[model samples]
Target: MNKGLTAKGRATRQRIVVATALLTREKGAAETTLDDVRAATATSKSQLFHYFPEGRSDILTAVAEYEAGQVLDVQQPFLGDLSTWESWQKWRQAVLDHYIELGQRCPLGSLTTELGKSSAEARAILTTLFTEWEEALFLGVRTLTSAEPEAARIRARSILAAIQGGVVMLQATGVTDYLTAALMTSTDPLRPTAEGTD
Candidate 1:
């Protein structure tokens, strides 16, 4: 969408996206409207169209991309390394803490449902996010466990699934137990054995 624009124009576009993201997080993507975005960003309809020619879908696609980055950002440092059990634990805690605090306000669920049918472009963005997330976890698993590559990959996918599932439950029930337990179970294998085996 940012094919050609001055730095100031890019900044203005980004400002709109960020504001829309905040509104989505607070009110949900399904509930959020172009009017809400306009009010939040103080942008007129023409300005919004100039920045996002496709209107709400385009802005939402951008926000989905941005929120996808945030999903990985919260698990950073530990997510980057995870070469040791300690680092994995730290990463686990970071994931747990983020979702627990977010509770029902988390936007992933709403984004998926809202964009799944609206546009292939939006769906692809989310697909990329999950792929990137799984690859990061797979790298960590490979580094920390001497298991076969395929096994490590499966483990990483399972862990990622656990997180997504737990978050779904957390959003529905407003309870952290589901997420907490899910992380513990999914990460248990990554912990070193008492015999110091990894």
Candidate 2:
């Protein structure tokens, strides 16, 4: 169970998280200071501590989780239901469009990399995000074929790897070619075999 918090408290906390995320995205986590977050959020030092008692680390973890959610939220209806070929295509386009818009900046990746050095919690947050993402892909894969659960699980993991690889390349080159090829090749198996074709 969670502790009860007033509406205002929740709003304040959300404001802080949103402000912090924005700052981190723009300035990179290593350069963002508590004072920066406080000023941007219009929060006092004590108020910041009231929400994040562990200080900068705690706030960074919250921002990491928020960014993780954004990764999935952008996928939307397509990600939730990839049972059909059309759905898969839509999901791929959504992913490509998102990265294209984001260019080389990956908020979650930057946050985790910056905070992961000293915070086990930051690593755990990233692990949880990847786990959930893989599970979602697994479920979607199962819908496409009668393959065994293990096989579907493997395929899902490969798909995730492809996406990550693409993102990494995008970060390095500021190009979408790798990501586009990754999504296409990874989803190729999901397409139904044409009549009498293996």
- The number of the candidate with the highest lDDT is 1
* Candidate 2's TM-score: 0.87
- Can you tell me which runs of candidate 2 are displaced by over 4 Å? 115-118, 194-198
**lDDT (0-100) at residue 70 of candidate 1?**
81
**For model 2, what is the C-alpha lDDT against the true structure?**
0.80
Candidate 2, residue 1: Cα displacement in angstroms equals: 11
lDDT of 2 by residue, 1-198 (tens): 014758888889988998888787677788999999989998999998888888898898888878888888898988888777778888989998898888777654464455444377777877887898898899888876756899999999999999888887776688989989998999888886311233
lDDT, residue 14, candidate 1: 94
Off by over 4 Å in 1: 194-198
C-alpha TM-score for every candidate: 0.92, 0.87
lDDT of 2 at 161: 90
lDDT score at residue 158, model 2, on the 0-100 scale: 95
**Which candidate number maximizes TM-score?**
1
